[model samples]
Target: MRVSVVINPKAGSVNPGLIEEKIRSALFRCDLVFSKAKTLEEMDQFLCEELAHKTDFFLICGGDGTVNTCLQYLVRAEEDLTKIPPIAVVRSGTANDLAHEIGISRRIDQAVRNILEGSVRNIDIIQISSGDKKAFMLTNGGLGIPAMTADLANQVRFSLQKVANCPQTAGFFKSIAKNSYQLIKKIGPGVYSLMVAEALRTWDPNGWELEFELPGDKKFATNAPIVLVNNQPSIGNKFLPAPFTSNTDGTVNLLLAEGRRVREHLSSFLHLRNGTVSQSDRFTSYEITEFKVRSKNPSRPITFFGDGEILFKDVAELSVKCLHKGLPVVVGSPAWEK
Candidate 1:
């Protein structure tokens, strides 16, 4: 069999030497082509050349961002979706949200083994559009709090890199900080409540006005501080914002917070894990096939993000639709066996 392996050396706690050794040992008989690039531009070039070769599968060793980037290029290169090779992922990222959802192992050897034994599953993809820009999302997409937090996280990472003068050291410190935060949040839900309280000190509740239409032409409008559209159940690692969300359900789960005060918002957020936030008077949740969102004030565009990456900035309007069975992925048996 012929395989194309795309590895992101900087993803999470990845040890390239160990990963490469495992790959070489496991697929010793298969014809393999390995590609690694530091920048997106370089990755594009490498993908263009490597994808043109007739290959059986793509083994992607990286985080969700790297997987998303590769998928973007693949979509652009292949005119026919069926012609694209099935993709298997190794969880080499901080969150690995999608990877975890698909039951991919974080261990390097086990992940590779699963790739060799996994079955192809058709998963939904979200098509997002704003003006002339369009992209696909595999996990989750949102505006408001998610976008805000992603921006803040990026800024923090950049500042750390600039001050530390070493990207690896910066990433190490960032991982430690994030792990600590996650540990605290896991230990007690009150940690998130405290965070929400602190965030409300500067958070503007009237940041965006949203109007959405459900499957049956049921329309609703709201001025919300945060809006999250989830295709997968988990966000940020362990937080289950939409516990019942299913990627193959042919619908997207929407979590909209209409709270205007810190206490109200905090109360709503605290119910995320229990999936009772939707029942709150201050929050609205919907299962819709498609939706359209525009800033209340068109002059002031809202920032939007998906899968922990910024997708649009200063965007006046955008639409999102669930693309049913859009992606062919190789998932571990644990995911499908159930």
Candidate 2:
């Protein structure tokens, strides 16, 4: 079998040496090519070369951002879904939401083993658009709090890199941040919790007056401080905004919550951390094929993010739809319950 591994060297705490060592131990008698993608141009070049080679499978070693980067290329590369090789994700990034949802192991050897001996599953991809700009979301998308926290987290990461001039020191700081994120995730808060707290200091209740167009042309307009569109279960790492979400179900999961008041938002946060947010009265949930959201007050534009990366900013309206069984992916033994 031929395999091409696309690696994001700056992802999470794992280094390339460890990943290569594990792959060598686990995979034998197979043609392998490894490519390091530290920038968009490099990743695109690698993909173009490997696609010509007709790689049988792509093993992506990074977080959700890296996976999304690869997916963007693939979505535009092929018109026929069957022509694309199945993708296998390895957990080697800060927020491995895709890996966790599909039951990919964090251990390098086990992850490679799963890629070699795993079942292929079809998963949905979210097609997001605003005006003429279009993109694909592999896991989740959100406005309000999710968008706010993603921006803040990115600023913090950038600040750290700027201050730490030495690459070694920057990597060390990244490891510390990643470890801190994981520790918080286990305690049920997730990394978003800390950033959310900081966000509340500048919180504006009137900022998110928006209108939602659900399936069947049903319109619901309200003031919601958080809105999430999910193709998978959790956001960040463990904050289960849509606990029963299914990526292959031909529909996307949506959640809207009013996190304006301190006490009300606090309760909502607790429910999110516990995976009970869907059942809470303060939140509204739906299963739909497509939806449109726009800022009711046109003066206050909205920004949305997907897979922990910002998609569009200062937009009056955005639309998202589910592309059922859009991508073929390899899953581990303990793959998500479908």
Candidate 3:
């Protein structure tokens, strides 16, 4: 089988020499083509060639953001679904959420073996639209608390990455980040609450006034402090916000939370990590095939984030729906188990 391996050279703390060694050792008999995508334009170019040639397996060696960026290109391609190859993700990012969900191994050799032995599973992708703009997400997205924490994390990541380019600070910064990366990945929800508290001091603490419309003409309005929509069960590889969700189930889960106070936010986040947020009166959960979210105040536009990145900035409305089995992914085991 021909495997097109795309690696994000700057993703997490991946050792390029070690990764190539493992790939060569594990995939000795396969026709392999490797590409390093350091920019979006480079990623697009490699993806175009891979799709045109119809590589059997497109292995993504990166973190969640890298995987999401690849999906953005795949979804926007002009070719049909058949032209797109089944994807395999390796745990090369700090928060390899999707890889963790699908039981992809963090070890390069094991992940390569999983790709060899894994089965192809068609999974749902969330299609998000705001006016004429459109984006696709495989895991989760949100406004309020989710977006705030993600924005903060991205900023920190960007700053550290920028400094890592400097020869003087590279070793020190990388060492700190590498040591703390796994620790923070495990205790993400608590860290997220702290980040949210900091954000509240600078952002609009009152939260957004928005309306949600589901199928059957059901409508509700909320001034909730957080609104998370998830195609998969987990967020950030730590919190199980939708424990029962299956990415292949042809529906997305919605979670609305009310936590205006810092203490309340902390409490809600604790429940979120424990997978009991929906049981509390402070939160409401729904499983729907599609929905529409609009800000009650057009003057105050709310930004939407998907898969840990900004999807639409300063947008008053969003339309989101599940495209059932929209993409084929190679999973080590059933995706919902983790």
**How many residue pairs clash per model?**
0, 0, 0
The predicted structure with the larger TM-score, 1 or 2, is 2
Which has the greatest TM-score? Answer: 2
In candidate 2, which residue pairs get closer than 3 Å at backbone N, Cα or C atoms, i.e. clash?
A: none
Please give the RMSD to the true structure for each candidate, in Å. Answer: 4.4, 3.6, 3.3
Model 3, residue 170: C-alpha shift (Å): 12
Candidate 1 C-alpha lDDT tens digits along 72-182: 888768877787888888877644678888888766777777667778888888888887788878897688765676655545444544445545566777677666544
Model 1, 14: alpha-carbon shift in Å? Answer: 1.9
Which clashing pairs does model 1 show? none
- Compute the lDDT for candidate 2: 0.80
lDDT of 3 by residue, 20-129 (tens): 78998989999999998778998899989988887888888987778899999998894466557899887777567788777887678878877777788888989999
Which candidate do you rate higher for TM-score, 1 or 3? 3
TM-score of each: 0.86, 0.90, 0.89
Off by over 4 Å in 3: 164-194, 200-203, 333-338
